[model samples]
Target: MTLADTAAELRHLHDAPELLQVVNVWDVVSARAIAALPETRAIATASHSIAATFGYPDGEQIPVDLMLDMVGRIASAVDVPVSADLEAGYGDPGETVRRAIGLGIAGANLEDELKPLGEAVAAVEAAMAAADAEGVPLALNARTDAFLRGRDRPRATNIADAVERGRAYLEAGATCVFVPGNFGEDVIAELVAGIGDRRVSLIGLPDIPAPARLRELGVARLSYGPYTQRVMLGALQDLASDLYGGGVLPRDIRQLN
Candidate 1:
């Protein structure tokens, strides 16, 4: 399907029965391979993986030009809707929306803790306005970083403030609100309850809960962040080490090739 068509389809998938299982793809090849899977319906990119692929850290190390190039390449290579993990939207809200839509990306993630809560919400609102101007429904997943740092930290100490910021993001035209880093089942349940019926999408960290359990908790989406890519790289390193030691390859090695 065309990118525009794919975006529309993804919007529809939000209402489907099963929770959206989003796999993070770092480049064109991985994006194509994952989208080729029968069960895969959409593609998401991990900022960390993307940075690592380019030999950089996750923080705004990569240039916007390079980042957008990677995004466009992935979008062109896959048939499913593509959502990018745009860290801090790369800047102000207007630029974020314009750049994302210009590249034909269906959605993006904007984080709150990267900036003051009020500025983050304002940025999201500006992005939403830009998306509207483009005539494409951009699914802005507003991320709250408070939970990632732990409740003992100053950020998580104020749950009410986080919830209020989340609500503000939703009001600014975000299709989903993502709170990463918190893992307690009860904590997650409370977040889901607080956000209640806002058409807001909640994404759970991979290792926290089983997919089935997360689904039961009313999570609309789930992602592994850089975990899968890290596993793949780690396995590759081990395989290389074993080969250097003159170890025989596993019987399934041929299948991998």
Candidate 2:
């Protein structure tokens, strides 16, 4: 598919009757591995995972160009649509997503970092405007950090704030509102109701409701942030330990990529 077609496909997937589960990839190899799967419809890049692969810590610590270079390579290496986590847009939300479109990124997640609502909404607008200029649908997942960073506040407050921000972002032309962190069925229902069914996205954080439950709650999408890479690294560590003890390799290794 052309980049625009893939972007439209991504948007359609989010609104599909089934829940859209995207495995986060950090590089061309990982992206290809997931994209090669018969059941995989899309790939979302994790900023933290990509940053770690480049020896940088999470946050916007990695140089924006370096980060975009990796994401662009991954997008180019895959046939499925690629969605990237462009953390806080590296200080320029508009230009960042604009460059992403040029690199063939079909979708992106831009966090608000719990900024003032007006500022967050403006960021979403800027990204949408960039997408408009590029003429790609660019499934913009406007992420709100309210629940992730608002633990000190009341739980109700967090939900309300997230819902409000989610609505504002949607109005600003975000395809979906990503609300990461652990949430139960009731809270999920509230978010879905307040933000609009299939408009609230979630993360695969530990102890959150399973995918089946999330689907029941009307979630649009679910994605792991850095957990996918972390889990693979843990397996690698285990393999190294076995090799150091003269153990043989696993018998089921396949040519995934």
Top model number, TM-score: 2
lDDT of 2 by residue, 1-257 (tens): 68889999999999998999999999989998898889999999999999999999999999999999999999889889999999999999999999999999999999999999999899999999999898898898999999889989998999999999999999999999999988778888889999999998999876679888888889999999999999999999999999999999988999775
**Pairs clashing in candidate 1?**
176-201
Task: Estimate the Cα RMSD of every predicted model relative to the unseen true structure.
Answer: 2.4, 0.9
- The number of clashing residue pairs in each candidate reads 1, 0
Each model's TM-score? 0.90, 0.98
Model 1 lDDT tens row, 154-254: 64464555577777888887876777774567666767777643333555454467777767777667766787698889999999999999987887653
For each candidate, the alpha-carbon lDDT, in order, equals 0.75, 0.93
Collision pairs in model 2: none
Candidate number of the best lDDT: 2
